[model samples]
Target: MIGGKGEQKTLRLVARHADIWHSFVRPHELPHKLDVIERWAEREQRDTSGLVISNELGHRGEDHADDLYDAGVRLFTLAFHGPDWDYDLVRRWLRWRDAKNA
Candidate 1:
């Protein structure tokens, strides 16, 4: 389940009830967020191994990819957004992601 701002409380509540803890967070702030999650787990004495942390990365750049990976982001959803909604743009991103993974 994806959660937004002011959603952390709901996220924590849902995290306990659900299988995933999905949210949008900047790469630079990920470590601190993860630390917060770790602390929350420690306090709740909850085994957080089953919880998944997912992030939305609009474009996959080397530095961003590395930062996200280092921050324990396992799932990434790339987006294509603008004044014009174009499938071609999304296709291009998929191609890029595929080549990078390759």
Candidate 2:
């Protein structure tokens, strides 16, 4: 389910009903979002051991990537937007990320 705004409650409901929680995340707010997830897990007495946390990183920014990783974000979808989509830029960023991870 794609949603925002009322995400805390929605996440709880989704956690209970769905197998995965795919959600969007703003770079600066990722920590708080993870905190909410941890809190929700504790409150619900739910084991969130294998929950998949995915986010779209539309541009290449080191801090954004680092913050997302620190917040336990595992999956990322990179996006490029413009009249002419830039595959080169996306490829460069992917290489950089892979190098960093390596």
Candidate 3:
């Protein structure tokens, strides 16, 4: 996987060598970042149709998943911290994902 926060060099590398690209970029910036990746892929003569876009949904998983999906993210990873964490968020996201898949 190629991981970066919308860096041009990183995107270029992704275009050249990756099947997956992961990042934590905000929803508002996702389109532009994708465009950059497309441009880089074009330059590298790579077909980006097989590229899988992934987003690390830090603390904003519940808030941004839908928007990120709309913006082209196909895979998601949630952030969990501490020993007292709750699984409710995971259940909710799972439900949402199920509904989307359905």
TM-score of each: 0.62, 0.67, 0.87
> Lowest summed-lDDT stretch of 10 residues in model 1?
2-11
Collision count for each candidate, in order: 0, 0, 0
lDDT of each: 0.65, 0.67, 0.84
The order of the candidates by lDDT, greatest first, is 3, 2, 1
lDDT tens digits, residue span 19-98, model 2: 55556766677667656766777788887777767776765476777787667767777766889978888887678679
Cα error of candidate 3 at position 38, Å:
1.1
Clashing pairs in 3: none
State the lDDT of candidate 1 residue by residue for 39-102, as single tens digits. Answer: 6677677777776778776655657766776777777677767778888767775675686578
Tell me how candidate 2 scores on lDDT. 0.67
Q: Could you tell me how far off, in angstroms, the CA of residue 31 lies in candidate 3 after the best superposition?
A: 1.4
* Candidate 3 segments whose C-alpha is farther than 4 A from its true place: 61-63
| Angstrom error at residue 64, model 2 | 1.5
In the order shown, the candidates' Cα RMSDs to the true structure are: 3.5, 3.0, 1.7
